[model samples]
Target: MSPEISVSTNEHKVLGACPHDCPDTCSMVITVRDGIAVKVQGNAEHPATAGALCTKVSRYTERSYHPERMLHPLRRTGPKGSGQFEQVTWDEALSDIAARLQAIAARDPQAIQPYSYAGTMGRVQGEGMAARFFNQLGAARLDRTICASAGAEALTQTLGHKVGMRVEFFAESQLILIWGSNAIASSVHFWRHVQTAKRNGAKVICIDPRRSETAEKCHQHIALLPGTDAALALGLMHELIVNDWLDHDYIARHTLGWDALRTRALEWTPERTAEVCGITVEEVQGLARDYGQSARAGQATAIRMNYGLQRVRGGGNAVRAIACLPALVGAWRQRAGGVLLSSSGYVPVQAAALERPELLAGRTPRTINMSTIGDDLLRPASPEFGPAIEALIVYNSNPVAVAPESAKVVQGFARDDLFTVVLEHFQTDTADYADYVLPATTQLEHWDVHSSYGHTDILLNRPSIAPLGQARSNAQIFRDLAHHMGYTDPVFAESDESLCRTAFGDQVDFDLLLTRGHAPLPVPEAPFADGGFPTPSGKCEFFSARLAARGDDGLPNHVPNFEPAGADPRYPLAMISPPARNFLNSTFVNVQSLRSIEGEPLVEMHASDAAARQIADGDVVRVFNGRGTHECVARVCERARPGVVNGLGIWWRKLGRDGTNVNELTSQRLTDMGRAPTFYDCAVEVVRV
Candidate 1:
């Protein structure tokens, strides 16, 4: 349903969607006055958004109109990483960039790489035109595994896709497990549903390494060690089996390889799980009891898993184990049951049509994992590494700040030989090292389309104002670059509005989106209720034969963190770098209001650890490991557990106290299954500076 738009001679409302990397994908109404966007608010009519917006998104107007917003193309005048640039005309910038890219393509198109991820989750602006450009150029394929790849791959292995129960159904759930998610900070709208479920006498449990705000409000919190989620899941399964909580009929009819999974789960006793997860045996037993009783009583029990848990060594296995729980007691039988890591798989996005990969003309270039860009960038061309990276086109992401092992990333970006171009609204840490910085428009000045991962809604964004100054949308920037490069592909001529329509084509009701601003997909209330799981067997597979064929374990099992707590003599603590509540990664770190709210970068340590290190609250401290040292204020509080420190992060490297953020201590090591970054599985120690 669409909210009513009020219009006058001088003012009117335009419908759009929040384009940030968020699950809500909130439907927004832009109040425009005389061709200028005056205000932005959530559409009350959108069920998932529920007329509410997070602090960062609510202040989007400030971001769009910030004083430092890049309004013109800039050419770097000083050395790389010097943050020196001179304004240039769009023609000069595009022509120079195109010429450089063409020169690199002439040698080897694989030398040119396009780096981007979720700066705008909009289909049209994100990869619609940009992908076409890269494919046509036969540039190196980027394996975008920075964030959700591990969990997404796990979901695909276990659930056949990243599908899940409808998020709105959580309100009717009798029990909710907010696993590895700080719902209050990252998923505000989903927290609303949990609050509603709480009001209705439902029990809530939070499973996370950190004692997040959501954990504080939950009925129970299991502060387990990071990367131990699979063990905990197995412990719960053991309890379900030993206590006779199984749904025998569901298991027999709708599951595959249950016997093997049962055997593996049975081996994990409560004591063993407690030791591995670094929690009390009582905590494990109590949580298992709660979950089993809820399922046995035929009440709805839901799990809201987020990407945070999957940013570890064994993240994929953890997701696989947790995904098997709903089927253990037939939780999918109820609309309010089952688990939701992502609802994205339910939406049938026409990715091939949108990206036009056929433009590659049968060329298969080398793939580069974004997580290991630090190492990849420094690697010379070889038999396996292929061509050395010569040109980098960055949009939507700031790798120098967000990528792990920032020291290496910085070293690679500082190479005078590397030609780099950035499209941004501000001079980010990465942009500071750019050969050219092209101005990119904000969501308020773009035509785009979005599909939500929190809800099954396809939302459309209509530009409310013209691009400010000389800024342009990401799609427009790519289209112009394609033209300058002498590309004759007709697809490059498509307008932003036409790209938005092409995003879904006939698969979705484009007419409905045009009228209502949002349209829900025809997904069922209980999609897997009758055991149609979209898997090869048409049922939940406890053991994936496909994985077995690939020589990996078919059944999910606990894989310990590469940097386990107390394993290193010098770095006895495990560090997890979660995003600051006021910022989404590094997006709003430059916003004065949001940055003021976040204060300075912080590393939260338990009182015991603080005392041992002679560090006091608010004391300047150095958090160090083998990789690098990060300087930040130490926050000694109950929010942190013993042996674990929380380094709230994604602060720009330039904004940090010592010109280094949390990523300075993070490694470039990848996860077990998806080859994604192991951001959380880090070992570190804190001491007074």
Candidate 2:
């Protein structure tokens, strides 16, 4: 393609996609001038993004050209975590890493572990070549279950699929429930659809522990206690059944275990549920009444289910209980009435081709859960546990700031024996502890494909600008490593274009995808309207025998978390750490603009709770528990529940007053069904410092 300049002198436009850890997967149009990227905006041609990018991504040029960006490979010159390194050539770095990994794999394959998450999220850079190399080396397999696994598992058990209502159909809804999600901040593109739905006479309701940005904008906010959403949902079910509001026909024909679910729900009375959830009995009954009326009146109601609810010990069961609500009310019969967990499955990618798991040659490497990184890092080598983690190759994640039990993770990183290799665009909190830090290209300088979890659009990205300095894409780096290691696998030889085309498969046209920014994936008009589920029973399993076989309750019921909701003598305050608006995990926390917009990280508690502790607003406070302690300014408001306190996550350790992060207070305990980390099931007490 020729360089097409705009009316402005020396200005050219290049197409790409935002590669942040977001569900939007927004297509971007970058403005380039004289070999430099000057601006970035959302592609108007894209259906989901619709010409509007989020606040954090609008300043892409600032982050891409930031002075602090890592522009070359470097080897540690001082002690670990000292952020002191000397420059090295790519060949030298790759050859050294390959030789070390080969030596480690010869002794025990499980000795090396590759750590990453949605930091890139692009199909190729996210998993493609890295997967091939790891599988070929028989390194420890990482279970990427840090974020949405538990909620996805619960939704799959109830709906038989993780796919949800088409986001374009949100405007057809008469009532929209934003449950445990602050779409306005996390998924700004989808928030536009909700705004349109509101304009179309949809009543918006937000259910969360804190009054988030979305809750503030919605017509109603149901602030419940943390980890008590299951009790509230079951109470609504009891009202739907006892008050004769349930669709009997829908239950009899399309659902199984109606009697069992009814019996279980009946045990949760509105009063009891209200007490558990810290809401009034009338509020619980009101939600049930409104939902029943909407169903009876043929008005569609949509539930936007987010991952926050499934971050507790009872999180899986909580999701199961909530997902069963739409079926009882016959909401799935309407156009957009069903619960929308995630739209990722709506667009299928050819994963077999991209990952090339055949590289492992039928050798199944030991699987390690990402949530238990701290535990695995600290564990000693043994015959039962395989070899202890000797080499830690980090990318697309900052576990030091984001992982649970952060103090323990730091301790593991401090080990002199651990050989840490980090690929990053900046010297992040985690990179400070690395033995070698390799510079990585920004999204604008990479070629990859992206699919949205909030919409069914598959978008393609092309390199908008040259990679700054000596930075390379993750795929390029891995390919270099494979060549240095003398690996002859054909998978490593595959080009990025070939891999992208392979991921699209024969079903999609690659040329057409490049012409247009995105294309909608083919799917049924009404996924569950005819009541044919993919489950064994060919119907929605209200009482999942699959779950029962796994030693869990078949019926959807409330399960208690590790921390009791009631006030305790030791730790009276419940800690709820959620993502902040200006940053995605630890991604943009280092950016000066975003950091200034977000201000300082602080602890938010109810005014009543603050009074009890004799802590005033803006007072520097120390929040502590058995796990660890952290200090921050206090923010007292009605937004937080009386016994609950909240904090924004993924702040750098250096920025905090006590040199600790929120994850220092989080637990490594797993959820009931999906084994996901129970991050929100934590307790702490805050006092004026």
Candidate 3:
């Protein structure tokens, strides 16, 4: 391993963006010396990142030039899951992949599935080129709904658009409600505004099942049972309506179906909701009173909602119900009063053009939701479901560690008939099972365009340094594969620079983006200030006819989740898996520095639960459900609620006790809407190992 050091006068800086799965797509400047990246720091000019980088990204140089990073293509020399491979030239690898893909296409092109997610936020390397290649081959469409899809769709239906309140408006808020999000860990840039809002006399409140780091720092933390967010939100609505605290004028002017929503809210009384949510009736009333009175007093309130509340059975409905709060209080009229669901809608990138979905060759391929990758991998082909997947090309994701039903996913990966290919920078747990592990370039060596979902900044990632070895960006890899497979579509030959230019519409100047590092979209400073929603009725849909047509609840309503009922003796505790502070998914967990900082993968249990199981704080415990089991060190404390436990996200099987990943105990059941994975709606039992 080489240490990153400044070369005095020879060191130069290049502007880019952090290409992680985070909402805060931070603008960055990489320090390069002698064609090697020496350091990574946030671009001071970018408002979202300010000038400081997060703990994980600050060590970008180490990750780029890590000794264990795969630098060349390799073919399997041992059995699957053995992590043994022999170096192969790019020519040999591409030829073999092309031949196999040709064979697969002859029988059924839909048998080829491309697995990916937000591994890199780059416009070209992340999604564009590969999507074009897959579309041309008429491959099965990967439904890419593993995260944010449910919330995005639900909010889109209610608010008519997914764009939330402006990030800059948080400082002007008088009340900040951080719901189901750990801003400190996931969205650090946004957390700065929260801190400033708190300093400016705004009351900060956090609502989460676990007392997370962000929760501990907030002025108030309301710990509720997991999957009960909808119930609590409805209870707040009930209090607001029963007490006549709603903004009837705003509702009449800027919304539709208010009567239906009001009727639904009245069904969940404070006492009933409190009992269901495991909170006191007084607490419920107090929350409604504070939010309602604060709004009526001309004090603006902001709700920062994230994906944590939407990984359950009623995930989409929960988001829709919570998103209606701002409208109920007439929050949209104020700069900082509306709900912030996501900033994704701010950038109008021509994704369909970049992906060239017209290349599907008139074959309406089967769509497979990514959340059910475990089931998809194991299930045999049937007449109803088309052909079984024969070849899986994985890039920008580690499904084995991050996907639900880890045991089943691993079992499917071990199938002898499956031909698996992985493109990665490191030998992740998923890579360990790949038949071909192709080396991939780090962000420093790639060209990409990034648009943040947390902020309205569009940034460019330039090649600060040359490719380290034979490594290639995902875009280049797909281009090479397409050429060898006899596809001469002009779209495959499109340059990364061209893709970046096409990411935004005419509002952006591509030349200026390269020079300035980042540029803000020409959107209104206060979007939705006048209540011109983009819905069918040009108003917020308090009752959505689209949902009703789909046989879903027309009004914002609470639907019960899959938490175990009647205090089942087999699985008594609910488990919530959240992102670790130091790692993004499973990306940085292998870095020695980050691994040391994160210490070990442990199960955090409440003191009472630990005591009942006769397990001490440091005791090794087994967490199991009917799905599967996992073992880890126990951290018994009050951080987690008595009936609930917490397991940090995406630890490799080898790193955990008894070689078990937390996802092993999680089910792959799809949510009622959005076909999202119900990761947080699981029941497990903890016992001494």
Error of 3 at 480 (Å): 0.4
lDDT of 2 by residue, 478-546 (tens): 888899999987789988767778786876767767777676788665677778877788888889999
- Scanning candidate 3 in windows of ten residues, the lowest lDDT window is 1-10
Model 1: residues with Cα > 4 Å off, grouped in runs: 1-6
**Candidate 1 lDDT (Cα, whole model)?**
0.93
How accurate locally is residue 503 in candidate 2, as Cα lDDT from 0 to 100? 81
- C-alpha local distance difference test of each model: 0.93, 0.86, 0.87
Better of 1 and 2 by TM-score: 1
Misplaced by over 4 Å in model 2 are 1-9
lDDT of 3 by residue, 1-689 (tens): 01223447788788878999998998888888877787899888788888989999999999999999999999999989989999999999999999999999999999988899988978888888998899889999888888888898888898887788888789889999999999999988889999889889999999999899999999888888888888989999999998878888889998889888888889899999988888889889988988999998888988999999999888888898898898888888888888897888878788887788789867799998888888888888999888999999999999988899899899988988999999999998889999898888888988888888888878888889999889998999999999999999788888877887876757677777877778888767667767788889988888999989988878766667787432677898989898888999888988899989888888899998899889999888888989898988899987898799998878888788777778998888877677888888888998998
Model 2, TM vs. native:
0.98
Give the top-scoring candidate (TM-score).
Answer: 1
